[model samples]
Target: MAISFAQCFLAVDDHDKALAFYRDALGLEVRNDVEFEGMRWVAVGAPSQPDVEIVLEPPGAGPGASPADRRAMAELLAKGLLHGVNFWTDDCDADFERVRARGGEVLQEPVDQPYGVRDCAFRDPSGNMVRFVQPRGR
Candidate 1:
Protein backbone atom coordinates (compact mmCIF):
# COMPACT_ATOMS: atom_id res chain seq x y z
CA MET A 1 0.00 0.00 0.00
CA ALA A 2 1.17 3.51 -0.79
CA ILE A 3 1.30 6.18 1.87
CA SER A 4 1.12 9.96 1.85
CA PHE A 5 1.39 12.82 4.27
CA ALA A 6 -2.21 13.43 5.18
CA GLN A 7 -1.64 16.11 7.79
CA CYS A 8 0.87 17.70 10.08
CA PHE A 9 0.28 18.76 13.66
CA LEU A 10 1.38 22.10 15.06
CA ALA A 11 1.50 22.44 18.81
CA VAL A 12 0.60 26.03 19.48
CA ASP A 13 0.15 28.03 22.65
CA ASP A 14 -2.90 29.83 21.26
CA HIS A 15 -5.03 27.70 19.05
CA ASP A 16 -7.56 30.41 18.28
CA LYS A 17 -4.97 32.79 16.94
CA ALA A 18 -3.41 30.09 14.80
CA LEU A 19 -6.82 29.16 13.46
CA ALA A 20 -7.53 32.74 12.47
CA PHE A 21 -4.27 32.96 10.55
CA TYR A 22 -4.99 29.80 8.63
CA ARG A 23 -8.72 30.25 8.13
CA ASP A 24 -9.10 34.02 7.84
CA ALA A 25 -5.83 35.09 6.32
CA LEU A 26 -5.03 32.20 4.03
CA GLY A 27 -8.71 31.28 3.52
CA LEU A 28 -8.20 27.64 4.50
CA GLU A 29 -11.22 25.52 5.33
CA VAL A 30 -11.88 24.51 8.89
CA ARG A 31 -12.17 20.77 8.63
CA ASN A 32 -12.92 19.88 12.25
CA ASP A 33 -12.89 21.45 15.66
CA VAL A 34 -14.03 19.19 18.47
CA GLU A 35 -13.54 19.98 22.10
CA PHE A 36 -13.97 17.66 25.05
CA GLU A 37 -12.93 17.81 28.69
CA GLY A 38 -11.22 21.17 28.27
CA MET A 39 -9.22 19.72 25.39
CA ARG A 40 -9.66 20.26 21.69
CA TRP A 41 -8.76 18.81 18.33
CA VAL A 42 -8.83 21.49 15.66
CA ALA A 43 -7.69 21.44 12.06
CA VAL A 44 -7.70 23.51 8.87
CA GLY A 45 -6.80 22.83 5.27
CA ALA A 46 -6.75 24.40 1.85
CA PRO A 47 -10.23 24.80 0.44
CA SER A 48 -9.51 23.10 -2.86
CA GLN A 49 -7.14 20.54 -1.35
CA PRO A 50 -8.92 18.63 1.36
CA ASP A 51 -6.19 16.13 2.07
CA VAL A 52 -3.62 18.66 3.26
CA GLU A 53 -4.60 19.47 6.82
CA ILE A 54 -2.83 21.21 9.67
CA VAL A 55 -3.95 20.26 13.13
CA LEU A 56 -3.67 22.96 15.75
CA GLU A 57 -2.77 21.01 18.86
CA PRO A 58 -1.79 22.08 22.35
CA PRO A 59 1.79 22.05 23.57
CA GLY A 60 1.11 19.35 26.16
CA ALA A 61 -0.97 17.14 23.95
CA GLY A 62 1.70 14.47 23.80
CA PRO A 63 2.05 11.50 26.14
CA GLY A 64 3.79 12.09 29.47
CA ALA A 65 4.81 15.62 28.52
CA SER A 66 6.86 17.20 31.27
CA PRO A 67 6.72 20.85 32.26
CA ALA A 68 10.20 21.42 30.85
CA ASP A 69 9.31 19.95 27.48
CA ARG A 70 6.16 22.00 27.28
CA ARG A 71 8.14 25.12 28.04
CA ALA A 72 10.77 24.24 25.46
CA MET A 73 8.16 23.54 22.84
CA ALA A 74 6.45 26.82 23.55
CA GLU A 75 9.71 28.69 23.24
CA LEU A 76 10.67 27.04 19.96
CA LEU A 77 7.16 27.57 18.60
CA ALA A 78 7.41 31.29 19.31
CA LYS A 79 10.73 31.74 17.52
CA GLY A 80 9.27 30.26 14.34
CA LEU A 81 11.72 27.41 14.67
CA LEU A 82 9.41 24.48 15.23
CA HIS A 83 8.36 23.98 11.61
CA GLY A 84 8.57 25.56 8.20
CA VAL A 85 5.38 25.30 6.19
CA ASN A 86 5.19 26.50 2.59
CA PHE A 87 2.33 26.92 0.12
CA TRP A 88 2.30 27.39 -3.58
CA THR A 89 0.43 30.43 -4.88
CA ASP A 90 -0.27 32.12 -8.18
CA ASP A 91 0.73 35.50 -6.87
CA CYS A 92 3.14 35.88 -4.01
CA ASP A 93 2.72 39.66 -3.76
CA ALA A 94 -1.03 39.44 -3.42
CA ASP A 95 -0.73 36.66 -0.88
CA PHE A 96 1.78 38.66 1.13
CA GLU A 97 -0.52 41.67 1.17
CA ARG A 98 -3.43 39.54 2.25
CA VAL A 99 -1.45 37.99 5.05
CA ARG A 100 -0.24 41.40 6.15
CA ALA A 101 -3.79 42.70 6.24
CA ARG A 102 -4.70 39.87 8.53
CA GLY A 103 -2.02 40.90 11.08
CA GLY A 104 0.66 38.45 10.00
CA GLU A 105 4.13 39.88 10.23
CA VAL A 106 6.22 40.04 7.09
CA LEU A 107 9.39 38.29 8.01
CA GLN A 108 10.56 38.68 4.44
CA GLU A 109 8.95 40.60 1.62
CA PRO A 110 8.31 39.03 -1.73
CA VAL A 111 11.51 38.54 -3.67
CA ASP A 112 12.85 36.58 -6.56
CA GLN A 113 14.64 33.44 -5.50
CA PRO A 114 17.55 31.80 -7.26
CA TYR A 115 15.52 28.61 -7.45
CA GLY A 116 13.29 30.21 -10.11
CA VAL A 117 10.48 31.32 -7.86
CA ARG A 118 9.12 34.44 -6.23
CA ASP A 119 8.42 34.00 -2.55
CA CYS A 120 7.56 35.74 0.69
CA ALA A 121 7.76 34.65 4.28
CA PHE A 122 5.52 35.50 7.20
CA ARG A 123 5.35 34.91 10.90
CA ASP A 124 1.90 33.69 11.82
CA PRO A 125 0.03 34.84 14.88
CA SER A 126 1.34 31.90 16.85
CA GLY A 127 4.86 32.53 15.55
CA ASN A 128 4.80 29.70 13.04
CA MET A 129 6.85 30.22 9.89
CA VAL A 130 4.91 30.17 6.61
CA ARG A 131 6.37 30.70 3.18
CA PHE A 132 4.35 31.53 0.07
CA VAL A 133 5.77 31.00 -3.38
CA GLN A 134 4.92 31.47 -7.06
CA PRO A 135 6.71 30.68 -10.24
CA ARG A 136 8.50 33.75 -11.60
CA GLY A 137 9.58 32.43 -14.99
CA ARG A 138 6.11 32.74 -16.42
Candidate 2:
Protein backbone atom coordinates (compact mmCIF):
# COMPACT_ATOMS: atom_id res chain seq x y z
CA MET A 1 0.00 0.00 0.00
CA ALA A 2 1.12 3.46 -0.80
CA ILE A 3 -0.22 6.81 0.32
CA SER A 4 0.90 10.28 -0.49
CA PHE A 5 -0.30 13.80 0.00
CA ALA A 6 -2.30 15.25 -2.83
CA GLN A 7 -3.78 18.41 -1.37
CA CYS A 8 -3.86 20.49 1.77
CA PHE A 9 -6.00 23.56 2.37
CA LEU A 10 -5.48 27.01 3.76
CA ALA A 11 -8.23 29.45 4.54
CA VAL A 12 -8.00 32.87 3.00
CA ASP A 13 -10.28 35.87 2.98
CA ASP A 14 -9.19 37.14 -0.43
CA HIS A 15 -8.27 34.94 -3.30
CA ASP A 16 -6.42 37.54 -5.37
CA LYS A 17 -4.21 38.63 -2.53
CA ALA A 18 -3.40 35.05 -1.63
CA LEU A 19 -2.58 34.40 -5.26
CA ALA A 20 -0.21 37.32 -5.29
CA PHE A 21 1.66 35.86 -2.32
CA TYR A 22 1.60 32.18 -3.20
CA ARG A 23 1.94 32.42 -6.96
CA ASP A 24 3.85 35.65 -7.38
CA ALA A 25 5.96 35.82 -4.24
CA LEU A 26 6.57 32.19 -3.38
CA GLY A 27 6.72 31.17 -7.07
CA LEU A 28 4.20 28.36 -6.87
CA GLU A 29 2.39 27.65 -10.13
CA VAL A 30 -1.33 28.07 -10.27
CA ARG A 31 -2.84 24.69 -10.93
CA ASN A 32 -6.55 25.35 -10.91
CA ASP A 33 -9.14 27.98 -10.19
CA VAL A 34 -12.75 27.05 -9.88
CA GLU A 35 -15.94 28.48 -8.48
CA PHE A 36 -18.88 26.42 -7.40
CA GLU A 37 -21.82 26.84 -5.08
CA GLY A 38 -20.88 30.45 -4.52
CA MET A 39 -17.44 29.46 -3.23
CA ARG A 40 -14.10 29.72 -4.96
CA TRP A 41 -11.04 27.46 -4.67
CA VAL A 42 -7.65 28.04 -6.18
CA ALA A 43 -5.00 25.35 -6.32
CA VAL A 44 -1.30 26.10 -6.38
CA GLY A 45 1.76 23.88 -6.31
CA ALA A 46 5.50 23.87 -6.68
CA PRO A 47 6.55 23.05 -10.22
CA SER A 48 8.87 20.30 -9.06
CA GLN A 49 6.18 18.69 -6.91
CA PRO A 50 3.45 18.37 -9.47
CA ASP A 51 1.64 15.67 -7.51
CA VAL A 52 1.12 17.86 -4.46
CA GLU A 53 -1.09 20.93 -4.31
CA ILE A 54 -2.22 23.49 -1.82
CA VAL A 55 -5.75 24.68 -2.12
CA LEU A 56 -6.50 28.24 -1.20
CA GLU A 57 -10.09 28.36 -0.14
CA PRO A 58 -12.51 30.65 1.60
CA PRO A 59 -13.22 30.26 5.30
CA GLY A 60 -15.79 27.61 6.13
CA ALA A 61 -15.93 26.18 2.64
CA GLY A 62 -16.97 22.82 3.94
CA PRO A 63 -20.47 21.60 3.25
CA GLY A 64 -23.20 21.87 5.91
CA ALA A 65 -21.47 24.71 7.66
CA SER A 66 -23.75 27.17 9.34
CA PRO A 67 -23.56 30.94 8.95
CA ALA A 68 -22.30 31.24 12.51
CA ASP A 69 -19.60 28.71 11.79
CA ARG A 70 -18.53 30.65 8.76
CA ARG A 71 -18.37 33.84 10.76
CA ALA A 72 -16.28 32.16 13.44
CA MET A 73 -13.94 30.77 10.84
CA ALA A 74 -13.58 34.16 9.20
CA GLU A 75 -12.72 35.67 12.54
CA LEU A 76 -10.10 33.01 13.19
CA LEU A 77 -8.57 33.50 9.78
CA ALA A 78 -8.46 37.23 10.33
CA LYS A 79 -6.60 36.63 13.56
CA GLY A 80 -4.07 34.32 11.92
CA LEU A 81 -5.33 31.36 13.87
CA LEU A 82 -5.68 29.12 10.88
CA HIS A 83 -3.06 26.46 10.17
CA GLY A 84 -0.51 27.35 7.49
CA VAL A 85 1.75 25.43 5.15
CA ASN A 86 5.47 24.77 5.21
CA PHE A 87 7.58 24.37 2.10
CA TRP A 88 10.97 22.82 1.48
CA THR A 89 13.50 24.81 -0.47
CA ASP A 90 17.02 24.20 -1.64
CA ASP A 91 18.18 27.63 -0.52
CA CYS A 92 16.45 29.15 2.45
CA ASP A 93 18.18 32.53 2.44
CA ALA A 94 17.74 33.05 -1.27
CA ASP A 95 14.09 32.06 -1.14
CA PHE A 96 13.56 34.33 1.84
CA GLU A 97 15.12 37.26 0.04
CA ARG A 98 13.05 36.64 -3.07
CA VAL A 99 9.79 36.40 -1.14
CA ARG A 100 10.65 39.47 0.89
CA ALA A 101 11.52 41.45 -2.23
CA ARG A 102 8.21 40.37 -3.70
CA GLY A 103 6.47 41.93 -0.66
CA GLY A 104 5.60 38.96 1.51
CA GLU A 105 5.18 40.03 5.13
CA VAL A 106 8.24 38.92 7.05
CA LEU A 107 7.50 37.00 10.19
CA GLN A 108 11.06 35.88 10.78
CA GLU A 109 14.35 36.06 8.95
CA PRO A 110 16.31 33.00 8.01
CA VAL A 111 17.84 31.31 11.01
CA ASP A 112 19.39 27.97 11.72
CA GLN A 113 17.15 25.85 13.86
CA PRO A 114 18.38 23.51 16.57
CA TYR A 115 16.37 20.81 14.85
CA GLY A 116 18.75 20.49 11.91
CA VAL A 117 17.04 22.83 9.46
CA ARG A 118 17.44 26.44 8.41
CA ASP A 119 14.11 28.18 7.99
CA CYS A 120 12.30 31.46 7.65
CA ALA A 121 8.73 32.55 7.93
CA PHE A 122 6.37 35.01 6.30
CA ARG A 123 2.77 35.87 6.60
CA ASP A 124 0.63 35.28 3.60
CA PRO A 125 -1.74 38.04 2.58
CA SER A 126 -4.45 36.52 4.72
CA GLY A 127 -2.20 36.32 7.77
CA ASN A 128 -1.36 32.64 7.55
CA MET A 129 2.22 31.97 8.66
CA VAL A 130 4.02 30.43 5.72
CA ARG A 131 7.44 28.94 6.32
CA PHE A 132 10.31 27.82 4.13
CA VAL A 133 12.78 25.28 5.36
CA GLN A 134 16.10 23.87 4.11
CA PRO A 135 17.75 21.00 5.83
CA ARG A 136 21.05 22.05 7.38
CA GLY A 137 24.29 21.03 5.66
CA ARG A 138 22.58 20.96 2.30
Candidate 3:
Protein backbone atom coordinates (compact mmCIF):
# COMPACT_ATOMS: atom_id res chain seq x y z
CA MET A 1 0.00 0.00 0.00
CA ALA A 2 1.11 3.53 -0.67
CA ILE A 3 0.01 6.79 0.81
CA SER A 4 0.64 10.31 -0.47
CA PHE A 5 -0.03 13.69 1.03
CA ALA A 6 -3.01 15.34 -0.60
CA GLN A 7 -4.21 18.51 1.09
CA CYS A 8 -3.49 20.68 4.10
CA PHE A 9 -5.56 23.45 5.64
CA LEU A 10 -4.69 26.90 6.97
CA ALA A 11 -7.01 29.11 8.93
CA VAL A 12 -7.63 32.32 7.03
CA ASP A 13 -9.58 35.35 8.09
CA ASP A 14 -10.33 36.44 4.52
CA HIS A 15 -10.22 34.40 1.35
CA ASP A 16 -9.17 37.24 -0.94
CA LYS A 17 -6.37 38.34 1.35
CA ALA A 18 -5.02 34.82 1.57
CA LEU A 19 -5.19 34.51 -2.19
CA ALA A 20 -3.21 37.70 -2.61
CA PHE A 21 -0.32 36.17 -0.66
CA TYR A 22 -0.50 32.52 -1.74
CA ARG A 23 -1.49 33.00 -5.33
CA ASP A 24 0.04 36.35 -6.20
CA ALA A 25 3.08 36.57 -3.95
CA LEU A 26 4.07 32.90 -3.85
CA GLY A 27 2.93 32.14 -7.42
CA LEU A 28 0.84 29.12 -6.51
CA GLU A 29 -2.02 28.38 -8.87
CA VAL A 30 -5.55 28.76 -7.65
CA ARG A 31 -6.87 25.26 -8.04
CA ASN A 32 -10.27 25.64 -6.48
CA ASP A 33 -12.62 28.36 -5.34
CA VAL A 34 -16.16 27.37 -4.70
CA GLU A 35 -18.84 27.31 -2.11
CA PHE A 36 -19.70 24.16 -0.21
CA GLU A 37 -22.21 23.71 2.60
CA GLY A 38 -22.55 27.48 2.98
CA MET A 39 -18.79 27.91 3.30
CA ARG A 40 -16.26 28.92 0.73
CA TRP A 41 -13.62 26.35 -0.15
CA VAL A 42 -10.42 27.60 -1.71
CA ALA A 43 -7.44 25.51 -2.63
CA VAL A 44 -4.07 26.45 -4.06
CA GLY A 45 -1.19 24.35 -5.38
CA ALA A 46 2.22 24.77 -6.88
CA PRO A 47 2.00 24.54 -10.65
CA SER A 48 4.92 22.15 -10.60
CA GLN A 49 3.32 19.89 -7.99
CA PRO A 50 -0.25 19.30 -8.97
CA ASP A 51 -0.76 16.43 -6.59
CA VAL A 52 -0.48 18.50 -3.44
CA GLU A 53 -2.89 21.23 -2.44
CA ILE A 54 -3.35 23.70 0.38
CA VAL A 55 -6.78 24.67 1.51
CA LEU A 56 -7.48 28.10 2.99
CA GLU A 57 -10.49 28.01 5.25
CA PRO A 58 -11.87 30.01 8.10
CA PRO A 59 -10.84 29.25 11.68
CA GLY A 60 -13.07 27.11 13.90
CA ALA A 61 -14.46 25.55 10.74
CA GLY A 62 -14.47 22.02 12.10
CA PRO A 63 -17.91 20.56 12.68
CA GLY A 64 -17.32 19.76 16.32
CA ALA A 65 -15.68 23.03 17.37
CA SER A 66 -17.81 25.21 19.59
CA PRO A 67 -18.04 28.97 19.04
CA ALA A 68 -15.62 29.49 21.92
CA ASP A 69 -13.28 26.91 20.49
CA ARG A 70 -13.43 28.66 17.16
CA ARG A 71 -12.66 31.95 18.81
CA ALA A 72 -9.63 30.43 20.46
CA MET A 73 -8.46 29.06 17.15
CA ALA A 74 -8.81 32.46 15.55
CA GLU A 75 -6.84 34.01 18.37
CA LEU A 76 -4.07 31.50 17.90
CA LEU A 77 -3.97 32.21 14.20
CA ALA A 78 -3.75 35.92 14.90
CA LYS A 79 -0.91 35.38 17.33
CA GLY A 80 1.11 33.49 14.67
CA LEU A 81 0.89 30.30 16.69
CA LEU A 82 -0.78 28.28 13.96
CA HIS A 83 1.34 25.66 12.26
CA GLY A 84 1.59 26.62 8.62
CA VAL A 85 3.20 24.42 6.02
CA ASN A 86 6.67 24.77 4.55
CA PHE A 87 7.41 24.97 0.84
CA TRP A 88 10.45 23.61 -0.97
CA THR A 89 11.92 26.04 -3.45
CA ASP A 90 14.65 25.71 -6.04
CA ASP A 91 16.08 29.09 -5.06
CA CYS A 92 15.34 30.25 -1.57
CA ASP A 93 16.86 33.69 -2.01
CA ALA A 94 14.95 34.43 -5.19
CA ASP A 95 11.71 33.30 -3.64
CA PHE A 96 12.38 35.36 -0.55
CA GLU A 97 13.02 38.48 -2.57
CA ARG A 98 9.92 37.96 -4.63
CA VAL A 99 7.71 37.48 -1.59
CA ARG A 100 9.21 40.43 0.23
CA ALA A 101 8.83 42.68 -2.79
CA ARG A 102 5.20 41.76 -2.83
CA GLY A 103 4.79 43.11 0.72
CA GLY A 104 4.96 39.80 2.61
CA GLU A 105 5.98 40.39 6.22
CA VAL A 106 9.46 38.99 6.53
CA LEU A 107 10.02 36.78 9.54
CA GLN A 108 13.57 35.75 8.65
CA GLU A 109 15.92 36.43 5.81
CA PRO A 110 17.36 33.56 3.80
CA VAL A 111 19.96 31.71 5.80
CA ASP A 112 21.69 28.37 5.62
CA GLN A 113 20.18 26.17 8.26
CA PRO A 114 22.35 23.92 10.35
CA TYR A 115 19.94 21.12 9.54
CA GLY A 116 20.96 21.21 5.85
CA VAL A 117 18.50 23.36 3.95
CA ARG A 118 18.63 27.12 3.42
CA ASP A 119 15.37 28.80 4.25
CA CYS A 120 13.45 32.00 4.88
CA ALA A 121 10.11 32.74 6.46
CA PHE A 122 7.30 35.26 6.17
CA ARG A 123 4.02 35.94 7.82
CA ASP A 124 1.05 35.70 5.56
CA PRO A 125 -1.63 38.36 5.60
CA SER A 126 -3.44 36.41 8.30
CA GLY A 127 -0.25 36.08 10.35
CA ASN A 128 0.51 32.42 9.63
CA MET A 129 4.18 31.64 9.20
CA VAL A 130 4.96 30.51 5.66
CA ARG A 131 8.43 29.15 5.16
CA PHE A 132 10.32 28.63 1.93
CA VAL A 133 13.27 26.27 1.99
CA GLN A 134 15.81 25.17 -0.57
CA PRO A 135 17.99 22.13 -0.03
CA ARG A 136 21.61 23.32 0.14
CA GLY A 137 22.76 21.68 -3.05
CA ARG A 138 19.73 22.28 -5.17
Candidate 4:
Protein backbone atom coordinates (compact mmCIF):
# COMPACT_ATOMS: atom_id res chain seq x y z
CA MET A 1 0.00 0.00 0.00
CA ALA A 2 1.15 3.50 -0.68
CA ILE A 3 0.37 6.50 1.41
CA SER A 4 -0.16 10.01 0.08
CA PHE A 5 -1.25 13.39 1.28
CA ALA A 6 -4.92 14.28 0.77
CA GLN A 7 -5.37 17.55 2.59
CA CYS A 8 -3.92 19.80 5.26
CA PHE A 9 -5.53 22.59 7.25
CA LEU A 10 -4.51 26.17 7.87
CA ALA A 11 -6.25 28.59 10.18
CA VAL A 12 -7.60 31.84 8.81
CA ASP A 13 -9.73 34.51 10.37
CA ASP A 14 -11.30 35.65 7.11
CA HIS A 15 -12.09 33.34 4.24
CA ASP A 16 -12.30 36.07 1.60
CA LYS A 17 -8.93 37.54 2.48
CA ALA A 18 -7.39 34.08 2.48
CA LEU A 19 -8.86 33.44 -0.95
CA ALA A 20 -7.35 36.63 -2.30
CA PHE A 21 -3.93 35.47 -1.15
CA TYR A 22 -4.09 31.76 -1.91
CA ARG A 23 -6.04 31.90 -5.16
CA ASP A 24 -5.18 35.31 -6.62
CA ALA A 25 -1.66 35.76 -5.32
CA LEU A 26 -0.28 32.21 -5.33
CA GLY A 27 -2.23 30.99 -8.35
CA LEU A 28 -3.78 28.01 -6.63
CA GLU A 29 -7.20 26.94 -7.85
CA VAL A 30 -10.15 26.62 -5.54
CA ARG A 31 -11.26 23.02 -5.31
CA ASN A 32 -14.13 23.48 -2.89
CA ASP A 33 -15.76 26.03 -0.66
CA VAL A 34 -18.29 24.89 1.91
CA GLU A 35 -19.91 26.23 5.01
CA PHE A 36 -21.20 24.28 7.98
CA GLU A 37 -22.28 25.17 11.50
CA GLY A 38 -21.52 28.81 10.80
CA MET A 39 -17.95 27.99 9.76
CA ARG A 40 -16.33 27.79 6.35
CA TRP A 41 -13.70 25.64 4.72
CA VAL A 42 -12.04 26.49 1.45
CA ALA A 43 -10.01 23.86 -0.32
CA VAL A 44 -7.36 25.05 -2.74
CA GLY A 45 -4.68 23.24 -4.67
CA ALA A 46 -2.08 23.83 -7.32
CA PRO A 47 -3.57 23.07 -10.71
CA SER A 48 -0.66 20.77 -11.44
CA GLN A 49 -1.42 18.68 -8.36
CA PRO A 50 -5.03 17.67 -8.46
CA ASP A 51 -4.89 15.08 -5.70
CA VAL A 52 -3.65 17.36 -2.95
CA GLU A 53 -5.55 20.20 -1.35
CA ILE A 54 -5.01 22.76 1.34
CA VAL A 55 -8.04 23.40 3.51
CA LEU A 56 -8.34 26.91 4.85
CA GLU A 57 -10.41 26.81 8.02
CA PRO A 58 -11.43 29.00 10.89
CA PRO A 59 -9.59 28.61 14.15
CA GLY A 60 -11.21 26.17 16.61
CA ALA A 61 -13.35 24.55 13.98
CA GLY A 62 -13.58 21.24 15.73
CA PRO A 63 -16.94 20.43 17.26
CA GLY A 64 -15.47 19.87 20.68
CA ALA A 65 -13.79 23.28 20.94
CA SER A 66 -15.15 25.77 23.44
CA PRO A 67 -15.33 29.54 23.20
CA ALA A 68 -12.17 29.95 25.25
CA ASP A 69 -10.41 27.39 23.12
CA ARG A 70 -11.42 29.29 20.03
CA ARG A 71 -10.21 32.52 21.51
CA ALA A 72 -6.84 31.00 22.41
CA MET A 73 -6.48 29.60 18.94
CA ALA A 74 -7.32 32.94 17.41
CA GLU A 75 -4.70 34.59 19.56
CA LEU A 76 -2.12 32.04 18.52
CA LEU A 77 -3.02 32.47 14.88
CA ALA A 78 -2.82 36.23 15.20
CA LYS A 79 0.65 35.96 16.71
CA GLY A 80 1.83 33.73 13.85
CA LEU A 81 2.39 30.87 16.26
CA LEU A 82 0.24 28.51 14.25
CA HIS A 83 1.88 26.15 11.75
CA GLY A 84 1.86 26.91 8.02
CA VAL A 85 2.50 25.12 4.76
CA ASN A 86 5.47 25.00 2.40
CA PHE A 87 5.21 24.60 -1.34
CA TRP A 88 7.61 23.34 -3.96
CA THR A 89 8.25 25.66 -6.88
CA ASP A 90 10.30 25.48 -10.05
CA ASP A 91 11.43 29.08 -9.73
CA CYS A 92 11.64 30.40 -6.21
CA ASP A 93 12.60 33.93 -7.22
CA ALA A 94 9.83 34.33 -9.79
CA ASP A 95 7.20 32.86 -7.48
CA PHE A 96 8.44 35.10 -4.69
CA GLU A 97 8.11 38.17 -6.86
CA ARG A 98 4.68 37.12 -8.06
CA VAL A 99 3.36 36.73 -4.54
CA ARG A 100 4.93 39.98 -3.45
CA ALA A 101 3.56 41.87 -6.41
CA ARG A 102 0.12 40.63 -5.55
CA GLY A 103 0.46 42.26 -2.08
CA GLY A 104 1.47 39.21 -0.02
CA GLU A 105 3.19 40.12 3.22
CA VAL A 106 6.88 39.38 2.67
CA LEU A 107 8.72 37.54 5.41
CA GLN A 108 11.98 36.90 3.57
CA GLU A 109 13.57 37.28 0.14
CA PRO A 110 14.67 34.18 -1.71
CA VAL A 111 17.88 32.80 -0.30
CA ASP A 112 19.91 29.69 -1.03
CA GLN A 113 19.99 27.47 2.00
CA PRO A 114 22.96 25.50 3.22
CA TYR A 115 20.92 22.31 2.88
CA GLY A 116 20.63 22.88 -0.91
CA VAL A 117 17.32 24.53 -1.70
CA ARG A 118 16.45 28.12 -2.47
CA ASP A 119 13.40 29.33 -0.58
CA CYS A 120 11.42 32.37 0.42
CA ALA A 121 8.62 33.09 2.86
CA PHE A 122 5.51 35.19 3.14
CA ARG A 123 2.81 35.63 5.73
CA ASP A 124 -0.70 34.88 4.62
CA PRO A 125 -3.56 37.28 5.38
CA SER A 126 -3.98 35.51 8.70
CA GLY A 127 -0.29 35.70 9.59
CA ASN A 128 0.72 32.15 8.77
CA MET A 129 4.25 31.84 7.40
CA VAL A 130 3.89 30.23 3.99
CA ARG A 131 7.13 29.21 2.29
CA PHE A 132 8.12 28.35 -1.27
CA VAL A 133 11.14 26.18 -1.94
CA GLN A 134 13.03 25.30 -5.13
CA PRO A 135 15.82 22.79 -5.24
CA ARG A 136 19.25 24.31 -5.76
CA GLY A 137 21.01 24.29 -9.17
CA ARG A 138 17.79 23.49 -10.95
RMSD for all candidates, in order, please: 1.6, 0.7, 1.0, 0.7
Number of backbone collisions per candidate: 0, 0, 0, 0
TM-score of 4: 0.98
Q: How close is every model to the real structure, measured as TM-score?
A: 0.90, 0.98, 0.96, 0.98
Cα lDDT tens digits for candidate 3, 26-134:
9999999988777677999999999999999988888999989989998999898986879999999999999999999999999999999999999998899999989
Where is model 1 more than 4 Å wrong at Cα?
A: none
Model 1 Cα lDDT, one tens digit per residue, 83-135? 76899999899999989988888899999989899999988777778999898
Pick out the ten consecutive residues of candidate 4 with the lowest summed lDDT: 81-90
TM-score (C-alpha, index-matched) for candidate 2: 0.98
- The order of the candidates by TM-score, greatest first, is 4, 2, 3, 1
Of the two candidates 3 and 4, the one with more favorable TM-score, higher being better, is 4
Show the colliding residue pairs in model 3.
none
Residue 88, candidate 1: Cα error in Å is 0.7
- Candidate lDDT scores, in order, read 0.85, 0.94, 0.92, 0.96
The collision pairs in model 2 are none
Off by over 4 Å in 3: none
